[model samples]
Target: MKLLFCVYLSVLFFSLFSCQNDKRVENENSLSIQREKSKLVVEYRILSNVKYLEDRNCIEKLASCKNPKAEVRFLFPKNISELGLDTAYQEDSYFIHQLGVFNKPIFNEDENYRIYVMTFDYMVSLVVFEDKRTKNRTFTITGKAKGIFWINSSYWIVGNDCHMGCSMSIERIKDPKLLKPTKEQNLDSLRKQLQRLPYEEKMKIVRQEGDELLFSANDTLYNGIGKKLSGFIPYQNSMILVFEQYKSNKYRFIQVNEDKSVEHIDSLVNGKFDTRQFSEDDMITILPKNQSLISLCQTIFKIENDTLFVYSLR
Candidate 1:
């Protein structure tokens, strides 16, 4: 009787252990599947219906579209005075009046920077400066869509009477590889992780409080038009709110602590003070106005080993 009882207990113990192991494995697999599905969904949503224009390939494709309404027309080709327009056209010698879906060379020589045309349902636009300065010059072409919508048709109308005679062309090229969202994605992930933590724990990292003194001031510091807060960089126990106080000038950095207090860091005289990042030995700041700085306008911020690095946006 004793031996039978011992055997029964051992079998029951093994059975329970096996079931627990199976449950653990199933849960892990479920989590893994969920993560993969989330990633695929985000990638598809971000990249769908997006086309890239590189080199001079799309120019011919744009010009060959048979859509009569989508035709590229040069509205004013004779002279600027004849058009009687009141828009600022800087660089009068080499200005583009109007462009449709056709691609063309923007600068004097092909310094790897090429412009492409894109048309949407509501507007026809151009994606210019795709070559070397791809990030900075990737601007949207916004205007009313005139003609037909056909498969692979890009068209643009040129403005007549411009300094340089307007022209349009197209070519075929492969799409650019999917670009990983480096900083933005990482920052969003960090914020999500931080938000998951308990409220008390999050407060320990960064506290939020209002400053009535700063809000009440009506001085030039806050009086400039188009002044708005853009973003911030949070460091060890502090955060910096980047703002555009003036429409023409670069962004200004205002540092804030965990207690919600804020202060302005002095602008660097010769050095540009665009973005702020903390370093063990010293803090690295990016300034846009520095003429000697090579990528003055295109800087990215990254953190490594608790040290922050600032990159210019040129």
Candidate 2:
């Protein structure tokens, strides 16, 4: 009788513990971080039945198949429009590299326009979009682009002018005409000035030392995160880092502010955690006031599953 009672109590405790663990996992899977005042919402949209041209399997198929072009269709999620994507979007190349890998989209201060420096085989294209609509693609420029930034109510493009003995050109494009460069100037003085910008400064400090992560903001040096620092991005006055805790086998997203305060943004288990997905390369558009949206595409070529992750923070 007593033995039976002990066994029953043990079983009940185990069930309750399991239930709690399951609930925690479910919360993490939902990708919504509920804080006291604000909520961070994450949406994962799958682009199914497609593979990149450079993918191992796709390359194998290209070698064996007679047809040079693979008839691949990218099926985006229904809610992609909300994530600032056009459902009827068309690309010149079927290569995934041309789509989203190297091109880092930048948003204007008003958040109305999203600009992309798309690289083609021959030349690079400067594409802009207003909301979910294609605003214009006529701003395409030649030569390799270093970076594009929005500074002082205009878009600044920095690129190498190999035609001019490998010198760099800093071109500015203002409103009315999105990217009609007024003039090309030497890059030495301007490069230093641009680095002093708050956004640029914050990006410089998020680095890794050996296996430990380090971030310095406003003279406060933050270190000792975990084995690997997956990625980080500057948000307002804070920098958010995705850290992989090898000992616990978990991933944590931590926000460190200029005031030396730290906040826990989110966490995920190692198995389901996405690494090398959050960085400056990902698109980030700041909404009108107090809210921002970040989008990243994750592709698994083996499974031919591509997902676009949109994270909304308020």
Candidate 3:
């Protein structure tokens, strides 16, 4: 097939890297970006006492430091667009950056927005900013390629850790920018078709159209809560709560009614088309073609600063 899948991943990578010789990571300099004097709170359901952060990069080495290479130059967050704020999500064919530190909360005590999505490259290539004090912006919208093993996006695709005598393959990317997913195998075939089903009424999820592979025949449809949409404003309307009135109010879409009432809903993501192409990676990909948005997306929401964080996965 692909040379018998690279000779069956070189006999499963030395029998799984010699029984997973992990040795507590923290190796260093495969890339390098460590600048987090503070930021690692974790746990946040929307807001029952909010908190969320745990980026961990270094190409999924889980940021013990190292992640983002091409030798590191413009890898990410160097003054992130000068923080003029309001770019919420940028993905010029994969230089990604979703910034929104807004009122500051890189570690908490919130005003909200501790989001900072950063993906390095996939290349259509072009960068000629001869600095007139001009920061880089360049461009590229869709040259296809962002990430999913060959690392990058959100991270971790490391796989094949069967106790190291390793020979499982699929990490090859000696550079060409990155991402060469070679057919992601739909979440590894929906984790082997969810091990023949019935894991407590189902919960598999690969659907975001990256290549279907679903399941949710009712774990009460994900009962209640779930977060990670990243850096303010991620409304797709499974029932209500939308925003985007100011800052480039591209066709309205409010809806804050409780009693104070006010419900507009104009061009919802360009005329009723919100498959949600935004991602600072709170990693959510379960729309199994919309079965009432899988129990209202487990009912979550979090729009900071202007405040509005709800939760309900139960």
The candidate that wins on lDDT is 2
Please identify model 3 stretches exceeding 4 Å from their true place: 1-77, 84-190, 193-195, 198-250, 254-314
Q: Each prediction's TM-score against the native?
A: 0.22, 0.30, 0.19
**All models: lDDT?**
0.25, 0.32, 0.21
TM-score of candidate 2 to 2 decimals = 0.30
Across residues 174-223, which tens digit of lDDT does each residue of candidate 2 receive?
Answer: 45243332121322232334335463232222111111111111101113
Clashing pairs in 2: none
At residue 180, give the lDDT of candidate 3: 16
Q: What is the C-alpha RMSD of each candidate to the true structure, in Å?
A: 26.4, 20.3, 21.6
Cα displacement (angstroms), candidate 2, residue 286, comes to 10
Q: Model 1, residue 199: displacement in angstroms?
A: 26
Predictions ranked by lDDT, top down? 2, 1, 3
lDDT of 1 by residue, 1-314 (tens): 99786565344322221222321233112212211111100000011121211221111222335553232221112222222322232122121212332323222213343333332211122223244554333222222111111112221211101011111111111221111111222322433454365535433321121101011111223333114333333334433334445444455544433322444543311222332211100111111111111111112233334433443321
Model 1 TM: 0.22
- Show where candidate 2 strays beyond 4 Å: 1-184, 188-223, 232-239, 246-249, 265-268, 272-291, 299-314
